[model samples]
Target: MDTSAPVRILTVCTGNICRSPVAERLLQAGLDQAVPGGFEVASAGTRAMVGEPMQPISADIVRTFGGSPDHFAARQLTPNILRGVDLVLTMTSGHRGEVLQLDASLLKRTFTIREFARMLDVLDQRAADGVAEAGAAVVPSTADAHDGASPLAANAAYWRGLPARAAGVRHLSLPADSSENDIVDPYRRDPGVYRQMEDQLAPAIVSILRHARLNAPSAEAAAGPGS
Candidate 1:
């Protein structure tokens, strides 16, 4: 892609009616709040319940997180959908594998939601350290930087840069165990299971939005005068 186009992020799950839609809404809401219009979030299922709405409990959880669950119909995953998406976040390692089976080249941009969250934590620390090392060099003068690049645009560029960064550090062990990286499917389970899914998804959404905000042009402008 076109960097000028909105960064598209896709969330994948088995049926699309539960985990993926919930994650999709939550991420969109969070990103909207953090950096309005910075990204677009959509969801699909490897084996989709096509045209179905999200599970009632899943919608409730989304509402609890202040996300709207309206008009959400399940979609089937396809290589075409994957082709345009900037990032793919899956509910489980199995889902990630399914996505990769569709398009093997997506390996770099595809990650389990928890895995990406953990990676974001690492990236944030590295960014902080980079700023410190360069003696507050994180914020470049907006005038000297790319013309007409808004903070959201700058953040979008940073978002695009993640795959390369991830590739460079692929050899390093992740901080969490691989087993802990998956968000278990809560379909037809009790309310508590749905809550568990919410617990897992919410923070990861926050982390991603937070990182995007940090790279936004507004953030750079806010930091400019003081330095």
Candidate 2:
């Protein structure tokens, strides 16, 4: 259905061509498959090799997971890019800090990609445990309770509320080790390092896609749809 702008998501990393590009493309592909025009995912780097294509290994990784890495050009992160972004998923904790340094206002909305995925996974499990959100909107009695909100608008509202909800459940979902929250950087590293990156990153991406499909608004029950 026609609606206002799609929810805007930004993925950040050191070069934009590796981890962030994979996150951006896969997320865009997954969300598009679930609900076309429902979200816009982009990527940038704190120290970008601007205009560069996705690194070969990273591009292959994207292809390995059913996402295309075509026509992607790295961009340097800026305050302007952060403006109006509904969510920001960074590759590392340091990158998350850099994102905040550019726009402190994003403190609540930004998360390390793995961390965010874990939080979503926790929420997904809670839903499976019969503790589902009343309407999947942030608040049913307040600002998010628009009766005629378009599906896209409802989607934006739901996702925009997630960081807060995720924050509230942080204690219940903390990683066993802090390092688990950050994706490993394999730039210029050996195949083993790239493998480590894949091992670390792929699961988080899967969690995100699974959770997104679980939460996406359905034509019959936006509580979820799509494979």
Candidate 3:
């Protein structure tokens, strides 16, 4: 697990003014509470929505969730932005393609927000299987006595085995039912639709927060009571 720097996340959409900004704010609020300075979340649009404030309907929905949308403004997605981010989480599949086209290297790091959440779910399962295997094979106090291997070495072996077990998961592709999990675009839609979108986004943001906690090395370390 890399703990070298803060996790930089960029959320994207067709126009930053609406869906992307709302998703950004939701993610920011969750991260501010859960991870603090350990991660960053920002949003942009594939087309130019630069300098625009979030739509009034989106703002209302944000307010209902007790979040202030003041800090976010629309911006255009650019190669530089995608290049700088550790994760590019887009609002839709089309938005995902746009970010990848900007930089193909981003394919490894980019995912639709819900898509990444699902990947995190897969990773969590892998980690659990690792812990269980370690517990079963290595008697904690005796691991260092039988072999010349240190307890740390035994632990490293367990960790090393995880990636191979998780190789079967398709990280880049979301299932066909992903639409039910996605934050439906509310651009030019009624305020009711905006509210519905916010509802979908808020839960996905929470799931992403949980996933980051489970995976981020810095987050795991800071999780200690006095740290």
What lDDT does each candidate get? Answer: 0.79, 0.83, 0.64
What ranges in model 2 sit over 4 Å off?
1-3, 132-146, 220-227
In lDDT terms, which candidate is top?
Answer: 2
Which scores higher on lDDT, 1 or 3? 1
What tens digits encode model 3's per-residue C-alpha lDDT throughout 4-34? 3455778888878877777777777766665
How well does model 1 score by local distance difference test? Answer: 0.79
The window of 10 residues in a row where model 3 has the poorest summed lDDT is 137-146
Rank list by TM-score:
2, 1, 3
Task: Flag the better candidate by lDDT, 1 or 2.
Answer: 2
Q: If scored against the real structure, what TM-score would every candidate get?
A: 0.85, 0.89, 0.71
Which numbered prediction scores highest in TM-score against the true structure? 2
lDDT (Cα, tens digit) per residue for candidate 1, span 24-107 = 998899888766777899999999999999999999888988999999999999999898788999999999999999999988
Off by over 4 Å in 1: 131-145, 167-176, 219-227
TM-score of 1: 0.85
Q: Please report, as a residue range, the 10-residue window in candidate 1 with the lowest summed lDDT.
A: 133-142
Please give the lDDT score for candidate 3.
Answer: 0.64
Q: Is candidate 1 or candidate 3 better by TM-score?
A: 1
